[model samples]
Target chain A: MAKVLLKGNEAVVRAAIEAGCKYFFGYPITPQNEIPEYFSKELPKIGGAFVQGESEVASINMLYGAAAAGARAMTSSSSPGIALMQEGIGYISKAELPAVIVNMMRGGPGLGGIQPSQSDYHMCVKGGANGDYHNIVLAPGNVQELVDMVQEAFDIADQYGMLVIVLADGLIGQMMEPVELRKPKARPIEPKTWALTGPNGGKPHRIYNLKLQAPDLEQDNIDLFKKYEVIEKNETRYEDYMMDDAEFAFASYGTASRVVRTAVDKLRAEGYKIGLIRPQTLWPFPYEAFKRPNIKKYLDVELSMGQMIDDVAIACGDKNMIEFFGHTGGVLITVDEVCDFAKKIMGGAK
Target chain B: MSRIDRIFCAGFGGQGVMSMGQLLAYAAMLEELEVTWCPSYGPEMRGGEANCSVTISDERIGSPLINNDATVGVFMNGAAYNKFKNKVQPGGKIFMNSDLIEDSNPRTDVTYYKIPVNSIATRLGKIQLANMVMLGALNDQAHLVNQDMLLEAFKKVFGAAKEKYIPINKEALAEGAKAAAEMFK
Candidate 1:
């Protein structure tokens, strides 16, 4: 398809439709509100369903219900709204249901503000709900990447029968850019043999998140962890920009990476061997990408007060020096300021 | 060096700040240049103080934000002018709506064009058309995109239902550009 100017929020819905997402259940929130709004308009035209649930909690449970019925289901929201969906998300993987959730992150611990933020890194990647489970997290840096990732999120969800979350900030959600809505790589469509298409011929399948017995739940957790290991091995993705001989790397993702890329260009022009290590997947964390021995240090940049910095520090380990520069409560950092910060880091680099 | 034009526009909610940024960004995209438009939305927009940043680059745009590196800025109110006056690059240009902003003692390094967008749009009998006038004036001074490409954007935005208003908007744009031609150069 030809390129069309689209907001990051609207692009998510378009990509979901292309990926054969048949049912969307989401409550409204700033920045990401466009996702459900667009879905509500477009999905019905394609003989699909778009339901605005009573609340974010209700919406996610609706998505869970749809996914259990063997339908490609999705729900999208911003910070507080997404936080409300945590229990439902935690419930999905144990039930072995496939669902896609988009959290266009906004500032806060609790309805902070309608500004872009990456503070929910721990919440999304660490499985904020009560469990030993992790959702497959896909972090897209731009609108095109966002489009591709949303489609990929669906495939990854179905392929492994796991929940996949596309983690983008409100900036990425509200920003407008031209994007070609195309599924570049078509993953093999997983057959819905496990779906409960009503007991007409085969044995009935009982699926629920409530694993009451201790050993049964423990075994399920072990199996789920094993599946996560397989996913980590296969689906871990990161992009290294100008990192072949980088002395220092800007470890970031999503909108923060976009600003850092410009800093890389500027700092490179100034003879600073700075590069970018943008993790496309927040989970699986792409620890292998940090094996660049040439990089003397890693500077983790983000819109939050350094949540992802911990992840980068974990990836880099004790050998390399890891520094953090971030803004809290939706205060944005600019390319110029990043360049200034990079210069200071370059001056101090070994 | 790849050209990157970072344009910022600010005003009250209905002052056409968003429209100016959108039109310019759309026109640049039509010209096959990389473009990104980001609005400071939520309370920053709908709560009255609206502002938007548009970046047009020959290369892939890294950040949709301009921050303190705007090559050009358009301000429709005194608050916008005050907030963004020091934000532009040293050699950048600012187009202020003189009719709305009274105290614009612009910085010496960056150039300033005080265009009377409100007065011009008032003359056109469409006060809301200040955004078009401001956009026309800015484009004329900067030559961010050709006149033809911008007209196409106006057409696309106005759509078929409002086809009749295109000519009026085009005239307003031309008038603003003509005003710019007189002031600049």
Candidate 2:
């Protein structure tokens, strides 16, 4: 397939289509409205379905209904709108249903602003929904990564029958870049024996989020824990850049990692031992990558005011030597600033 | 020539700021270069101020957001000019629409070309063609992208219906480029 220029929002939807997503239910929000708009026009051409639900709450529930019925379903929203979908997300996770949700985060504690932000890190990775389960969060640093991660999000969701979220910021969502849209190999069809579809030739199955007895719920939790253990072992992914002799390491994800990469590259060229550890999966956070024996100091860079910093601190296991740099509420940091900060941190490193 | 070009364009919402950035970004893509286009999306973009940042590089781009150090700036109005005037990198170039912007205090460190892009487009009888004129002026100054690539972008954007206006757009672009050549000489 030839490459085409696509915005991050449009690229995700196109990837979803190639991944065999047949149903989409979403509400419109700034920076990500392109997703729903593209789907509404293109999904029908492929004999798929697209619905603009009454609200974010309604849209996510619509996704739940579709996914429970044994269809590849998805929904997308920005921060506040994603917050509205948390209960539904919890229900989908509890029900053990497969669905893809995209959160193109914006600046927010409320309706903060319609700009790119990474502040929703804690809300997303820490389980915004009230539950014992966590989403398989895939964060991408660029538009190409966003496209690939969207396709992988669907496959991972079906492979584990779990919820997978692509956590991107408004910057990546709205940015346009050239992407090669290939026809992905069809995902192996998983047997949905527990689907809510009416019995035709087999015994009927009932699937819901409710488990009444304490013992039974505990057993379910135990089962989920077992599945999570497998995911933790098999799914943790991170990229190590110039870590061979890194005395100082910077940990970041998504767009922030992009900035840090340039800074690391520039600093490395200038005889600094600074490297970068970029986690592609925010959940099952790659703790192993941070275990560099020679690393003297760790800096966690993010677009938010250090929400992911806590995870970096935990992953590094030595919070004493950890530092954080970020800007919140839609403010962005530059590569030169990051390089300067890295130089300053190296000056103070032990 | 710089290895990477980071260009910013700003104007009122309807002044084709986003389209100007998109045209250049698309042309860069056609040349198989790494590119990114990020628009300022918020309430201000609804019918008021709007801007877009574009980066074309041989290497993968870092951040799409440009807080400072834009290699080139295309301003269509006074507000846009005032907002982005200081952000241009020293020795970088700025192409200002003199029809809409009155002030042209050129910075000693940066080069400024005051092209009445809107006036040229209006003379072509399509005020909306101002973005193409600006693009032409940009190409003439920076040589950031090839002329043929941009014409191909026009074909891709306008499709089969371009026959009626392709010549007009080509004239607009050429006129703008010619204006740029004459000014520099």
Candidate 3:
């Protein structure tokens, strides 16, 4: 198929359809309303289901219901909306159901502005609401990556029987770009042994996390962590740019990482030994990318006030070696600011 | 050698500034170049001053926001003109709406052209064609994408509008292109 021009929100819908997402449940929110809008108009045409829930609370629970029934279901929202869905996300995590959730983050500690932001880093990667489980979060830098991540999120969700999140910003949701539409590929079918289908002859199929005993719940936590360990070993993804024998590096992801790319290129042209480590998978966090032998310092750039810096500090294993440059409440950090910081950091004056 | 061209378009709401920039972006997509189009999104965007930034490149676009490095600035009113005149880079170009702007404190650092877009569209008997008129002038000036590709993009975007207005839009485009060519002469 020919490449088509698509805004990030529109691409999410198309990619979800390509990934065989049969049910969508979401509410209207800035920067991501197009997801539900497209699904409402297109899902029915494909004999799928689309429901605009009364609120984000209702929407995420709908995703939980559909996923428990062995259907590929998804939902999307912005920052504040995602906050309302957190408890449901915790439920989905505990239920061990396969689901895809898209969070096109906007500014927020409360009801913030409708612009791009990466402020939900801790909420998305660490825990949103009383969670002992981590959502496999993929941060995509551009529209093409957003498309790829949306499709991949479904497969990963099913693979681990977990929730996967495509953590993009409002900028990626609103910006328009050209993307080659991926051909639909069939997902490997897994038998729905635990699904709530019609019962077999006197067979018990239980799918619940309601262990009354403390030791039993603790064992559940330990088993979940063991699965997470396997994911951490096999699923961590990152991009290394110009890191060979570099003295300094910037660790960033999503939209900020795109700016870091240009800054690294321009600074390298001026003979500055700077590189970038972009972590595409935020939950796995890609600590291996920060283990360069010649690295002397690390600059962290983001759309929030150093939320991702904690991860970078841990990845670098020296909190003092990492410096942060960021703006909060939807103000974007420019490439010039990143490059200037790169110069200052590599000069050993920080 | 391939390069990125950043274009900024500003006008009052309903003047099709976003549509104009998107049309060019779609044309660039048809040309198989890397492109990004971002419009101002805020409470003020509803029937207020509006602007969009478009970047077409051979390499992946780094950022979609327009800083002070626009290669082309298209202003359709005095407010847009006053706001963005100083933002274009040195040796860049400004295509202004002469019908709505009387005087501009011209800068010698960049090329400037005053195209009578509204007048051309009025003469073409459809005021909405003003954006198409300006786009035609931009084509003459920047040569960013082929004229035919733009027309094809227009057909795709203005698909419903074309059933009744394609002929006049075509004429408006040619007339704007002709006027722009005459300016260079």
Tens digits of per-residue lDDT, candidate 3, A1-350, equal 78788889999999999998999999999978889898999999999999989999999999998998889999999999999999999999998899999999999889998889999999999988894889899999999999988998888888888899999999999888888777535556477688876577857666785789999899999999999998899789998888886788888899989888988888888888888888999998898888777888898999998898998888879999999898878888887888888877777432
- Those runs of model 1 whose alpha carbons end farther than 4 Å from true positions after fitting are A348-350, B44-47
Give per-residue CA lDDT, model 2, range B84-138, as digits (tens).
8887888899899988898746678888888999889999999989988988888
Clashing residue pairs found in predicted model 1: none
B1-185: candidate 3 lDDT, tens digit per residue? 46989999999998999999998999998998999999878765555999999999988787777778899999999998898887788999999999998764578898888899999999888888999899988977898998888877887777865757667777877887888888978
Give a tens-digit lDDT track for model 1, residues A210-276: 7689999899889988988998999999998999888888999999999899889888887788899
Q: What is the DockQ of each candidate?
A: 0.77, 0.72, 0.74
Error of 2 at A241 (Å): 2.0
Give Cα-based local distance difference scores for all models: 0.87, 0.87, 0.88
Docking class of 1: medium
Sort every candidate by lDDT, greatest first: 3, 2, 1
Mind giving the per-residue lDDT tens digits that candidate 2 earns over A126-237?
9998869989999999888899989988888988888998999998998899998765455665788778889888888778689889999999999998999999998999
Better of 2 and 3 by DockQ: 3
Best by DockQ: 1
Candidate 2 TM-score over all chains jointly? 0.96
